[model samples]
Target chain A: MSDKDTTYQVPIGPIHPALKEPFMINFRLDGETIVDAEAHPGMNHRGIEFMGMHRNPLKVIPLSERICGICSIVHQHMFTTAVEHAAGIEPTNRARYIRTIMAELERIHSHVLWAGVAAHEIGFDTHLHFTWKVREKVMDLLEYIAGNRVNYSMWTIGGVRRDITEKMYPKVNETLDYYESLYKKLEEIFLGDPSIRLRTKDIGILTEEEALRLCGVGPTVRASGVKKDVRIDQPYAAYGDLDLDYVIPSRYGYENTGDVFSKTLVRLKELVQSIDLIRQCVDQMPEGDIDSEPKKAVLLNKLKKADGEGIGRIEAPRGEAFHYARLKEGQEELDCWKIRASTYNNLTTYAPMFMGEQIADIPIIAACIDPCIGCMDRAEIVEINSGERYSYTHEELHVLSVEKTKKILEGSL
Target chain B: MNTIDLPMSLDELESYFKEGLGDSISDLRKEEIKKGLNNRPVKLIWFTVSRGSFRKSIELISDIQIPHLSVTSGSDLGDVVELIYHFAVNYGYPGDEVSVNIKVHLPKDDLTIPTITDLVPGAITTEREKQEFLGIKVENIPDSRRLWLDEGFPEDRYPWRWDETGMENMSRYVHDKEEAANPPTEDTPREGGGKDE
Candidate 1:
């Protein structure tokens, strides 16, 4: 705790206030500058992969959706696509476009949600409120399409559960027009703000070399100038039919410094790109059956007969989300199911990014990668060794967070 | 960005591994699921090799233009547990990306394989995870600590295994009033509770 003590180590959390989910970070510091850092994630692990193995292919779709609250659609999309791939059931062209539209809509909402969180971390509450207000439109569109706001159970093994009726087209177009019109305003608030630039421009810089070496994916890698996107590379859904562009920082005015600013720019550009993608999917959507085979019993029979494996991946809002599935012939349950969320790939880069950053920049730097511990938290119910259930109530957790914030503010932490 | 003779199809990619690695890979099979439900053709190359050649096969896979290590997952396959290392090659190119799966089967008697963290440091997390959940010991891994499992979690009680010693009872939620009233508790003599080493 003393300034003279060179070997000062500060442990952040298994549960922290700034983070949306629970994950611990230990920072080894020399005075105020971090010399080394380690991230201990998986506090909220629900053992979703383990759960998926016991359930049939048709039943695991909803379980996959619960992997993360933000990127629920991406999880479902990947899992269903993998199962569909393994079963050799090709979805109708209309179904593929619908999937594409839903995924892009999810991306728009997710990016805006992340922008608000990043803003709040920097103590800019107004930006958080405004960004979230604009984000509601996307959420509403999602709710209208799938009947739920967060985990839309739209993805089925063979095809989507619901169809976008002709009545919904005007509503979808209106939402797109609104977002396109607000793009300049959103850019001005996020990119043009002087304070935002000052806080994020040079902080948490991840070089292209570090990015590739660490296997960083999604916007995190894009921010670093490594032009890789699973959407562009392995064009799934309706992504192949539509013309696409990779959203990298250098394409805009910013240099490929891979800083928090670069990441922010990439995400903002992606929001616009996602808007364009949704428009394209809607316009080019063909008229056909959503499912190759609609009956549940027949679909299950097809999956049962298929003795093969396939891997499905998509560029989620944060990064590349992958699902690998193996189905044995004449088996009700999955032979093998593995999910690798983007946060899992992105977390490896944390040590390098946090190495030389000051303690004050920890929140922003950590938030810059958009680390979602919920996706990585694969916890299991192990018997408590202490023979005591020491669980915190919501109020207690809030009070503890407030006390920690106070300590951080007073600079005694 | 010079396309210096990239493998044009799944067969070319498979032959590249065969010609390049020789007998290091004991069994090799490529399953091409051509544009099934999507435009992306999944070229899955299943490489089964002896435990001794596991790391070498990965290094050879890395030599194929530094493929991104997607995820390393394990499944209990009767007497042997199959550890599948999924890698994505040629990203950012539409319909050119290949899913190269290098699978190594380790018998239940000897549950260990050399770690690829040195080749792909990003693989440390997945290796650690496979070490925990599937009980597949990753030798010479940079970090030996548990990745996600709780500290009090009993050792050798892998969740993925449906066989004996696996915690299959907890897989599904059954409303047992007796178990709920008094949860099982045995002190695990481990340091840092559940923190990584």
Candidate 2:
């Protein structure tokens, strides 16, 4: 084909390595720059919202946790808060603190995990390894406190299931101190390192206007200088009492450039914010009954009689995790259930961010949002008339991206 | 003394709607839903508008500085599907989020509503979802292609519906205890549950 006739379309997923979860991005490229892009995500669709409506109110907490593995505790917290609202159940002060502790710890681990993934996307293997090595401490603490590493079944309708006893205080404090020490190391390596700065500084710029118009949440919008955090705006659990500061890029001495670098800074600082929140929860935890009634029988009995709807919106490490539950009077099951996971709202920002960016920058720019495709992966690429199927593995896409980067550098693109 | 009894922002949001929408609103109720130990109450303001005022209701809510459209959920009420559009009012105002949901009931025969994608681009995915799962046709949606389901999947069969054709395999979960107590003979194995023994 002639150079004028060679406009190409690239299919980059359904299954990919640059992302931790499954989703597809088909881009229409004009030479070296992306002209337009379409995201197809459903490969990981488990119909959790649909399924949540079918199950008993109490049983859906664990199911909701599976919506995003990385944000499991956040999901549980959202679901429980909604159910607690509908049922008119108030968790004790201690339970609120415990829930906050668990959610913030999850945020720390999740943000650290995202940092490693972002580092890997930029071809920094040592940085990825180092970031993940620091993540293990938080993971171990999660295991020690909640008794599970990934999906900590810590939340219930009225309160938390497990209490953070006095004995666990030492380990929790130690983990917080451990994460505190790594903050400088993380910033020095990810932000101070010249290569990372070169790759991420002005790449994939998303302005505050675009962030607001697209309804970006969590770190994605925070990095773009929107001081909107669900925890700060609509405090749930112990967030109101924590007196926390919003962790945006501007606060860390960087003008919000709304780029991959800003995104990295937002997440890294959130790691620090989460650690402080957890320590505060530990220190301020009061002695009280964890739940109005700890038994599932009493909880379910109470919920079955609830006759109202409640909205639970929390700031997951990624962004705002929202859950809406309607419980009709005298019904054991939910009338309607909807989950707007943070990643779902953030997904809309991708097409805008992808515009005018180089192929090589796609991985990190797309990863900059910290997308959790596990919550949203219904993807397919098909020809309209012929019904022909097209797909690309993560390796093939990565190679294509890297090749384009090299071409641009050689002035041959 | 329940902690959930605190004053809610839903009252403020309701008054905003009452002043803005006026006669367009059919029903509005603000309820204090959840209470936190530190006096942060989670509040919900639910209102229903006629299908004619659905678009106006959404526009008014957006005008009230609540541009964040969280999610839209629907439930099958036999002949009608009640669609609830949830928005976070007073967003970015710390500890003052009032969830204002504008609900509209669309009949099964006419399952269409004007798309909010133009007003809020973030709503495209959720609108696409309702189109696929709830079988609610979003009129003027930018992309009408199936969002979650494959092209080859049955177009008439919606996953969230409670009709005879929908969720056939999942009938056990949908059916009430009385119906579930006696398993449908068609679902049960024939002749002592033997496989060509």
Report lDDT per candidate: 0.78, 0.77
For this target, which candidate reaches the highest TM-score against the unseen true structure?
A: 2
Check candidate 1 and list the clashing pairs: A13-A24, A45-A377, A45-A378, A45-A379, A218-A319
State the lDDT of candidate 1 residue by residue for B55-100, as single tens digits: 7777776776655888987899999999888887766666687777
TM-score of each: 0.88, 0.89
The prediction achieving the highest DockQ against the true structure is 2
Write model 2 residue lDDT over B5-119, tens digit each, in one string: 2223566667767776778787788775344556766666889888887887778766665278878877777899888888876676677777778889999889999999888
Model 1 lDDT per residue over A342-370, tens place = 98999889899888877667777778888
Worst 10 residues of 1 chain A by lDDT: A374-383
Query: Model 2, which residues run further than 4 Å from truth?
Result: A1-4, A374-392, A399-413, B1-12, B169-197
Report the Cα lDDT for candidate 1. Answer: 0.78
